[model samples]
Target: MRMTALSAVLALSVTAAAQSQPAAQALLDQGKWQEAASAGAALNTSAGLTLAAEATTAGASLVPDNQKKALFQKAQDYASAAIAKDRSNADAYFELARAQGRLAQFVGVFQSLGLAKDVKANLDKALELNPKMAGGYVALGLWNATLDSGGLKGAIAVQATGASRSNVAPNFEKAISLEPNTPIHRIEYANALLLQGKKAEAAAQLDKAVAMPAVTFWEKRDLEQAKATLAKLR
Candidate 1:
């Protein structure tokens, strides 16, 4: 009787953990980053940990540069934990890549360039696990574009990491095709174009991105960023 009762309690706990996921996501959708992170950290599952990582990384965007590296590292830790919980969680790998990209910004030239391997590997694994993940393609596009923007250093890094600007347009186009209505994809593509000094093309993409309807906090943030970037071009 005692064993059966304990098993029943364990099942209920598992069910509650699963049920808590959407609540955390609701906070994330509303841009309540801290709340979402806290809620996610309280749960034991990979999905919950992934949410915490996403929230931390997203929060890093709104912070000062001095503060961003720590947040990105925290997000990376959360993502790694999520992967430990479930290796097949595609989003965990994707979140790891995202955190790595942000963390790269806080390091020196060689260190930042070195991170390309980790970023690319996680992104590749994410896409391999879920071939149709548009965000993975968007990240790949950005990876190529950012690395190629480094001038001579970029060339060396490109050779070292095997990341080519040749891949940027195709990856971005794939992301745009997969998620045509996602403003972030358009905004990211414009960013890549700007890196290549294609001001006119960047402006066109920004125009389209700003005109799109934004339903989530992240989308709205991207829409505002697009507007700011376009204003600079004009």
Candidate 2:
């Protein structure tokens, strides 16, 4: 399935949090959900966005997928608090988008679609406020590509249109340039390429994504599945 940008934002938040081994691990071990949650809540500006992202990510990591709504709601609360403190905070918007996206994913609720759109608007505003915001573009591109690709329907669309995987190449390409190391972008792009019967190209992208030092074990496992699926096509 084509994962949404919201999913990427949430995943990125968690991944950023995991990078700080000691702090995140300590909070997790202590069951300091509130503190951890608070720490994430604090990342609302250019100066502290990274920190905030990591904290929320740590909190999200502790919450199971089935219980993600509650966790995301907490994240949203934090994000809202940050926004209240700084109305023009781009990072705050990103975090809010992440939380909403997680909630959307948890329930597959159509109402969540509007929330995702809201996220895109925030991201768009973030870019207008700061054009150098590479993360914003990456997140936006992921959301667009996922929706456009349409999962199994996207595959069928590809076949029906006879457009080839090359047709959807731009979205993934843009995403990669914005965040070359994010595994999701490559995997999603590879999926598109595979649908177009561009097996070798897809494999190459997936291989590179899998090999990234930053890719988590589970992400690597997913890449492996993409590779395995591609191999079958070959």
Candidate 3:
């Protein structure tokens, strides 16, 4: 009787946790970053940790500059925790890479150089774990394009860090193929094209991105940026 009772309790707990996941994910999808993070914090699952990491990283942009690093650090910690729980959790690795990349933005160039390796490694691992992960491809594309734009500095950095510049277009193309409806992918690819002085090609991408419907807050922000860039190009 005691064993049966315990089993029932466990089943109920599992059901409740499973139900919370959708609610947390809904918060994330809606860009309720703080609420999503808080919801994720209440759970003790890999999904919860990954959601927390994503929410924290997304929320960092809304915080004061000085608070951004700490938020990203928290995001990194949550992602690491999720990885600790499940090594095959590709989303966790992606979130870690995203957090690290965001943190790099606030640091000096030398500090950013050091973090570039880590960001690439995590992104690579995420892709290795989940080859179909379109977001990972986008991140990798951005990495390649950013390094390629640095010219001599980029060349030295690539030589020193083993970051690839040759895969920029292919990576972005792959991401776009995987998630054709995602506006950010096109926007990012447009940015990369602009870096290479392909203004006409970039404008075409921006036009597509600007026309896409943005459901999430981040997507809306990307769409706005795309519009701004397109206006300038025109």
- lDDT scores in order: 0.92, 0.60, 0.89
- Choose 1 or 3, whichever is better by lDDT: 1
Model 1: per-residue Cα lDDT over 33-150, one tens digit each: 9999999988968999999999999998888888999999999999999999999999999999999999998899889877889999999999999999999999999999988886
Per-prediction TM-score = 0.93, 0.59, 0.93
The candidate scoring highest on TM-score is 1
> Could you say which candidate leads in lDDT?
1
Error of 3 at 207 (Å): 1.3
User: For model 3, which pairs clash?
Assistant: none
Clashing pairs in 2: 165-196
Query: Residue 77 deviation, candidate 3, in Å?
Result: 1.1
Off by over 4 Å in 3: none
The residue-by-residue lDDT of candidate 2 on 1-234, one tens digit each, is 357978988999877755544453355335565564444444333324333443565456556676666767766766677677777777777767667666666654356556666766776776666665555655665555444454675554334333233335564566577677777677766666654556788788878776765434345556667667656756
17 in model 3: Cα distance from truth in Å?
A: 1.0
Model 1 poorest 10 in a row by lDDT: 148-157
**What TM-score would you give candidate 2 relative to the actual structure?**
0.59
Shift of residue 41 alpha carbon in model 3, Å: 2.1
Error of 2 at 53 (Å): 5.3
Query: Candidate 2: what lDDT?
Result: 0.60
